[model samples]
Target: MNRQDDLVAEGEPEKEFNPGIAARLPRKTVAGGALIRDPAGRILFLEPTYKPTLDIPGGIAEYDESPYDACRREVQEEIGLDREIGALLVVDWVPVLGPWTDALAFIFDGGILDDDQLTLDPTEVRTAQFLTLTEATPRLRPSMTRRLALAQQALTTGHPSYADFGRDS
Candidate 1:
């Protein structure tokens, strides 16, 4: 028998690849964010015009775009900063809740900023500021708080962390 037909279960036919079949496979949403800190170690947070709570500088990845590239794109779009995105800090798997689908979120190191001016996108962001963890906790959603903590830990340890629903796993 030829190499293409070798040992095909002795009698079964080989199946050809199908794009339609592949398109129906399960998929997850991906998002990326940057963990930017000020020289005094305060984290940067953005008040989104569409959302009630504060968020980091990032957004959902576009179709066929990589998480790292998404981070870079979002940072520039959201904060008007083209700083280099550094190492991956944390990856959190968020479960389906309410109107939101399950998603994989990534946080990358954005290094420290001393006096970088940020020009916010008026349609997307209302304001951006640096706040201490203690001051930021109340402004952020619970899951975001946990994710931020894990990202900070990863930065301190020079390692990456995995989380489920923002809890370390």
Candidate 2:
């Protein structure tokens, strides 16, 4: 007998299959952005329209898009800088401590930008400017200041670095 006939003859009930929701695991947000420098070696910052704090050029990645690509795209969209991103400078795992969920944030090396190429979209970015680390420190949020410090260290050491909420992980 065929497999179906054999099963029927054995008086065994057929099993019905249901593909319900798959198991859910704790999820973390992945955001990617870059620390761009100008010809003067000053870091770039975007004045965001939505938030009062200055931000590096980047945003949350869309579904299935790599974080690296997301960073490149965000730089182009936010600041109108269509340049290739360089080495990975920092990968920070920021834990969930407040309203935001846990996040894996990436900071890529955005090679120096020429003066003429600087552009901004006022709807998303009010302005863009380069600032020395000391100048940027007071303007950046605490976590961002930590990420920037680590990225600078990585650049100096010629090695990629990782951190968990500002502490080495």
TM-score against native, each model:
0.88, 0.83
lDDT agreement with native, every candidate: 0.91, 0.85
Per-residue CA lDDT of candidate 1, range 48-126, in tens? 9998999999999999887888999999998899989999999999998888889999999989988878989999999
lDDT of 2 by residue, 1-169 (tens): 7657866888965454544323355767898989888888788998899988888898888877778989999888888878889999999998887788999999999888776576687789988888987897787878888888888888899998899886666
Error of 1 at 10 (Å): 29
Off by over 4 Å in 2: 1-23
Candidate 1: where are CA atoms >4 Å away? 1-19
Clash counts for the predictions, in order: 0, 0
Clash pairs (backbone) in predicted model 1: none
| lDDT (C-alpha) at residue 158 in model 1 | 96
